[model samples]
Target: MLKWLRPLVLLLLIGLLGIFGLRWTQQNMRNAIPSANSRVSPIILVPGSSATQERFDAMVNELNNKTKTTSSLLKVTVHTDNHLSYSGTFEPGRSHPYIVIAFENNDDGYSNIKKQAAWFNHAMTILSTRYHFNHFSAIGHSNGGLVLTRYLEKYFNQQKMRINTLMTIASPYNFSETNIDKRTQMLTDLIHDNKKIPSNLVMYSVAGTENYNNDGTVPFASVEAGKYIFQKQAKNYTQITVTGEDTTHHDLPQNGEIVSLIQQYVLHISDTKQRPDVNVRH
Candidate 1:
C-alpha cells in the first residue's frame, strides 16, 4: 500500500539533510578565509642600523600629506626572546597600510644582518597569518636592505605571499668597499644567492650622492654593486642616483626626490616627477 511512499519520504529527508550539512560546512569555510578585498597590502619598511620602528615617522607624514587619504601606521619590534611588541592601529577599509619592522638587536655587521633576516622572517610569518595579506611592498634603508636580501634568499616564499616591489635606499651592497672589484664576503654571498630573488620582481636600488662618488656614508660603487645581485635576477632593476639637497645616506630616506619616487613607483601614484639621473638597468 503506502509502504513505498514512506521509503520515498525517508530518502528525500536524508538527501535534504546532506545538502544542508554541505552548505553549512562551506559557509563556515568561507567565514574562516578572508576575502580578497578585506585583505591589506602593506608597505613593510625596515630601518637602517641603530634605528628603531619610529625611523620612518617623518617620511610617512610627508607621504600622507601627498595622499588624499591618510594611511594607518603600524610599528612592530621583534625582541631577542622571539616575542613581538606592536604600536599603532590599522584603519578599516585602508588597503595600503604602512608597517615598520625593527629588531631588538638593531646593530650593524654581517652576522647581525643574518640574525635580523631570521627575525624578519618570523615577524613576517606572524604578520601574514594575522593580517591575511597575500602581497606586500618592501623598502629597506642601509643595512636593513642587506637583511631583506638575506631574508629573500633564504626564507621568503613567493607562493605564500608575493612581494610587489622592493626599494633599497643607500644600501652598501659591497659593505663600505668602494671598489667594485673587491667584493666583501656579504656581497659575495648575496650575489651567489641572486637566483633566489623573484624573477618578476621590480627592484629599485637607490644611491644617494652628496659628492659624485659617494653618499657621504656609503660609497657610490658600494651601492652600485647591487647590480651584481639584482640585474640578472629581477624583471627590472633600476639604479637611481639621487643628487640634490639631503642626499646623504641617512637623509636619503626623507629626501623630497625619494618621496616622489616612492609615490610614483611604490605607491603607484601617477603624474609624479622623476629626477633626470634615474638609470634603468637591464
Candidate 2:
C-alpha cells in the first residue's frame, strides 16, 4: 500500500508541476510577443457572424495582390489557425500587418467572445512590440465587429494603442430589441457599458436596406447603433449607406456596391494614390 501511494503522490506532483510550468511558459511567450502598434502597416481583420477565415480569402487575396502591385515594400498577410485551432501558434512568416479571423462551430457563444478577444489581444501585443505600427485598422462584419469593438473598449483604454480606422459591415451593434442569442446579448451589453467616445478613432458603419431593419441577419437599427456609438466617442465619424440592393445582412459583404464602398473607404483612409474597382460579386 505504501509503495502504491508513493507512485500516486509522485504522479500528482508531476501533474501539478506540468500545469504550473505550462502557465508560466504561456505568460512568458505573451510577454515576449510585441504589440499591434509595432507592425508596418498593420490591419486586423475580424470576420462577421458565423464566418471563418475562409470567407475572407478572396478579399485578402485581392488586397494583397493590389498591395503587391503598388509597392514591393508593403507586406499583406492573413493570420489563421490551422484546423481552426486557436492555440496561438502563428505560422512563422505570417505574423503582423495581417488579418485575424475567428472560427467557432460550437454552441458556446460566450466562450467564443473570450477566445476571439484573447486572439486579438495576443496579435495586437505582437504587433505593438515587434514592428511598432503607428496605425492599426480593424474590419469586422456582423457579430465579429461587435467582438472587436468590445475588445477595444476593454483593452484599448489601458494600452498605448491608436486605432486609425474601424469599419463594421452589417454588424448588430445594439441587439437589445431583437431576439438574438444569449451570447450575443451578453456581448452587446459588454460593449455598451465599455463604450468610449471621441478619441482619435475613425469609425464607419455600413448597413443595407433589404432585410427587416437589418442587412439580413442583423437589423439596420443595430448597425446604426454602431455608427452612433462611435460618433458619440469620436469626433471623426463616417457612416456610408449602401442602398438599392436587395441583399440581406448575411449577403452584404458579398454585395458589389457594399464591397466597392468598403474599398473606397479603405483607400481613402490609407490615402492610396490609386483606387481599385469594386467589382465584388453578390
Candidate 3:
C-alpha cells in the first residue's frame, strides 16, 4: 500500500508540473502589437498553431501604440475572428489595407489547408468588393504560414487579385519525408507543383541561427530553407534572421528584435507598394 501510494503521488506531481509548464509557456507566448495610432490601415489578426483570437490582443495593442508618428500615416484596426468573419462595413472609409495573420493552432483536425484557403478567399472577395482593397498582405507563423502559402497556390493564382506581400515568422516550409504530417505533405506538394498552383506573390521569411538544432517546435532547416523553396519557385522573395537570447521557436514572436522587425515590415507594407528588404543578423 505504501509503495502504490508513492507511485500515485509521483504521477500526480508530474502531471501538475506538465500542466504548469504548458501554462507558463502559453502566458509568455500570448501577446499583440496594435497598429500604431495614425492614418495607416486596418489589420485582421490571424492566430497560429493552437492559438485563438485572444492570443493576438497583446501584439495588436503594441502595434497600435508604437506606430504613432507626426506623419499620422499609420492607423490600424484589428479584426479577431477564428473563422475569418468580418462584422460591419469593409469600405474604404470603414476598412482598408487589411493584414491577415495566420497562426498554427488554428489548423485543427477539422480545419485543413483547403478549408483555410477558402475562408481567406471569401474574406478577400468580401473586402475587395466592399472596401476596394485590391492589394492585400498576409503574415503567418509556423503552420499558419503554410496555410497562407497553400491558399495563394490554390485560389489566388488565376484571379486578378493582388497579394502585396507575404511575411512568415519561424515558419516550417520544408519537411523531411520520413516525419511528414498529413497537412504538411499537402502543403509541400502544392508548393513543389508550382504549375498546378502558380502564384506571383512576394514572400519574406524570418528565422534564427543560435538554435540550429530546434527552436523548441521547428527545426532550423525547416524555418530557413522553407523560404528558399518559395524563392526558388517565385520571383520575389527574401529572408531575415532574428536571433534571441531564448532563440526558441516559441519565443521568436515575443523577442524584442523580432517584434521590431515585424513592426517594420508592417509599416513598410502600410506605406508603399514595394516590399521592403530586411536583414537582421544575430
Model 2, 1-282: lDDT tens per residue? 998999999999999999999999888776542344443555566775467655555555455454442211122222435223332223324333454555454112555665666556665665456555655677887777767877776656433666777787776666633533333455456646545532767778787767455555566665666544576576477777777764776666666775565556654423256577779978
**Which scores higher on TM-score, 1 or 2?**
1
Model 3 agreement with the true structure over 214-236: per-residue lDDT tens digits? 66677666666564357666656
Backbone clash total for model 1 is 0
TM-score each candidate: 0.82, 0.62, 0.61
Cα distance off (Å), candidate 1, residue 233? 0.6
Off by over 4 Å in 3: 1-45, 69-105, 108-111, 157-159, 175-184, 195-200, 269-282
lDDT sort, best first = 1, 2, 3
Ranking by TM-score: 1, 2, 3
Q: Residue 205: error of model 1 in Å?
A: 0.6
lDDT of each: 0.88, 0.59, 0.56
lDDT against true structure, model 3: 0.56
Model 1 regions lying over 4 Å from their true place: 1-38, 271-282
Q: Best-fitting candidate, measured by lDDT?
A: 1
